[model samples]
Target: MHHSLFLMGAPGGGGNSSVLLIYLGLMFVVFYFFMIRPQSQKAKKQKAFMSNLQKGDKVVTIAGIHGTIYKINDDNATMQLEVSPGSYLKIEKSALSMEWTMAQQKAAEPTK
Candidate 1:
């Protein structure tokens, strides 16, 4: 039957299965490199950014609120953001928007 398949211009079963396995393996590797790896790295970077936050550093929240860090409550993972002088809001640490805050910082930088 295998020889007959070759004569009929069809792939043999044994070779096809190995090729299918190779394709499936390549797909998983592609997904890991293109999808999984970058996502994990970004999460790590975000975590580090959140951990290093300090008082007086400006930040934007996921809800689009822009403010400066007034105080951090490490015990409860929350912070007080000063949107304006004497005006503060307490929000969760996870609510900070790393991307937006970085973009705002870049935009505020003085270019040579």
Candidate 2:
């Protein structure tokens, strides 16, 4: 009886162990697709947007200052923003907000 109980508690059941491992792997895959994958795609898009910034593009700073790109320094990863006539501030490239692409497109439309 003791031997049977010991066998029951022993880690020798390959069948059950394999099932548990398969379940864990499936769970990890599900979590990755539903949670991790989308976040990584968003990060990739944001990084591309940040790297493609250019002069004359209107942008808002992370600090909520709206301005146009006056200068771009690819070497230093910085931007000079023109907030107003004769008013400019140097800011890190990462501090820029999403590109105002929609507003620019609307402005470029021919008046009917």
Q: What is the lDDT of residue 6 in candidate 1?
A: 45
Tens digit per residue, CA lDDT, model 2, 31-96:
999999998997898888887778887887767788888999767588899999889999988887
Candidate 1, which ten residues in sequence have the lowest lDDT sum?
3-12
Compared with the true structure, what per-residue lDDT tens digits does model 1 show for residues 25-80?
99999999999999999999999998899999989999999999999986759999
Clashing pairs in 2: none
Candidate-wise lDDT, in order: 0.90, 0.78
* Model 1: lDDT of residue 73: 84
Model 2 score (lDDT): 0.78
Model 1 misplaced stretches (Cα beyond 4 Å): 1-11
RMSD of each: 4.2, 6.5
Full-model lDDT, candidate 1:
0.90
Model 2 TM-score is 0.66
Q: Each prediction's TM-score against the native?
A: 0.87, 0.66
